[model samples]
Structures are given as C-alpha cells and as structure tokens.
Target: MAHPLDYLYFSAVMYTSLGIGDIVPTGHMRFIAGVEALNGLLLIAWSASFLFAMMNRLWDWEPCVEPKDEE
Candidate 1:
C-alpha cells in the first residue's frame, strides 16, 4: 500500500506533467496519469485564456483597477 502523502505527491506531479521520474505509475495507473496530465494542461490553458479575456474587457491596455462599465 502507498502512503497518502506519496499518492498525493504523485498525483500532483502527474497533474503538472512534471515527470520527475522519482516515482513511476504502473499498469492502469499509467493511463490515469496521462489523462490527468492532459486535463491539467487544458484547464490551465482555459484559465489563462479566460483571464486574458477578462483583462481585455476590464482594461484597455491600462493598469487600472476598476472594471469597465458595460453599456
């Protein structure tokens, strides 16, 4: 059995696609790790794009804090 903390660390490494190689997933776990890495990559990309859109809407290339008033 694997320790909880070790499992967590492994999951995080998979999620981040770091591939540190310290711990290797075997059998079915390998598929899960691959999926997790893809999911993480997509979510990160989505979040970044969403944030960029929000920033575009909120500021017109200015460092202002107030959100733009929508008509």
Candidate 2:
C-alpha cells in the first residue's frame, strides 16, 4: 500500500472478515488475509468457551424445595 492508513484499514477488514470489497488483496496478501480471518474466528470461539465455563461455575443450579404443610 502506498499509505500506512491503507494497510491499517485493509488489515482491520481482513481480521474481522468484513469483506467490505473496497480494498482487495493480491497474491501472498490474500493468504495473509485468510490467516488473519481464521485467527479472529478462533479467538472469538475460545473467548466464548471461556465465558461459558465461567458462567457455569458461578451459577447456582440447585432446585428449590417447598416446605411440607402440616395439618
């Protein structure tokens, strides 16, 4: 890219898989873009798994018991 801002914008689009179509990568850059997209996806999946596990650990799952009525 002729300008630094162009590369930054292109990298952002690739990592997020936005596919905005405003800028296109060529040759080796295409492979780099694919890798960036994959990395982003993996990071997101890993984060979700971690959050789910944390929530499960923190939640109280015991069922409530009703008191017996005495005559």
Candidate 3:
C-alpha cells in the first residue's frame, strides 16, 4: 500500500487467479479479489468460444462422392 509496485503486484496476482498466498487481502478487498478471479474465468471462457467459432467457420468438410462404374 505504501508503494505503487505493491498495487501492481496485487493486481497481477488477482487478475491471473494465482492467489499465491504471499499477500493476503482483508475486508472489502477480498470481494475485489473474488470478482477479479471470476472475471478472469469468464474472459478465458469467452476466448475459447470465440476461437472455436472462428475455426469452425474457417474449416469446412464435404462428403466425398464416387463415380458409378459403367455396366
């Protein structure tokens, strides 16, 4: 709290959902950590869905047709 680097360190840990246990959050700060973890999860899920949709759209599979033999 005294130095700017402390805030950066806390934010990096919270956003990544690492919860390294080196620094503990108290009171309302705990709520913020929970929210950050949830947001990170949602963001990851959204990214996976977006990538799946993009890949599906870009890749297409067609059934192969065989020619009939002459009698």
Candidate 4:
C-alpha cells in the first residue's frame, strides 16, 4: 500500500507533466490522478490571483501609526 504523500507526489508530477514512470496509476486510480492534476493547475492559478490582489492592496495602503514629530 502507498502512503498519502506518495499520491501527492505523483499528482504533483502529473500536474507538471513530468512523469518519471516510477509511480503509474491504473484503472479508476488513473481518473483520480487526472482530477488531481486539474486541481493542482486551478489552485496554482487561483493562488497567483490571490497573491496579486493582496500585493496590490498592501502597496496602496499605509502604516496604521504615523511617526510623532520631534520635540
């Protein structure tokens, strides 16, 4: 039996389209790997969007506390 991390690594390779031939899925498992690949791709794209939005918001905003004037 394979560990869960094995599935994750396999999925990652498939998502990157870099199959190394050590872990091959057969039967229904093949469909599962396909789904994982699709999920990885979508998640990566969504992350990119989220990161950009966050950066834009941060860049436009200012610090909460302003510096006090010197005596």
Task: Report the Cα lDDT for residue 40, model 2.
Answer: 79
Q: Per-residue CA lDDT of candidate 2, range 1-71, in tens?
A: 26999888888887777769788888898888899988878887889999999998999766579766698
Global CA lDDT computed for model 1: 0.89
What does candidate 2 score on TM? 0.67
Q: Pick the candidate with the highest lDDT.
A: 1
lDDT of 3 by residue, 4-66 (tens): 888788878878788897878889989988999889878878999999999889989565797
Best by TM-score: 1
Candidate 1 displacement at residue 18 in angstroms: 0.8
Give all candidate RMSDs, comma-separated. Answer: 6.4, 4.4, 5.3, 5.9
Candidate 1 lDDT tens digits, 4-65: 99989998988887879898989998998999999988988899999999998998685579
Separately for all candidates shown, the number of backbone clashes (residues 3 or more apart, or on different chains) is 0, 0, 0, 0
Instruction: Give the higher-TM-score candidate: 1 or 2.
Output: 1
Which residue window of length 10 is worst by lDDT in model 3? 60-69
Which 10 successive residues of model 2 have the least lDDT summed?
60-69
Task: Pick the winner on TM-score between candidates 1 and 3.
Answer: 1
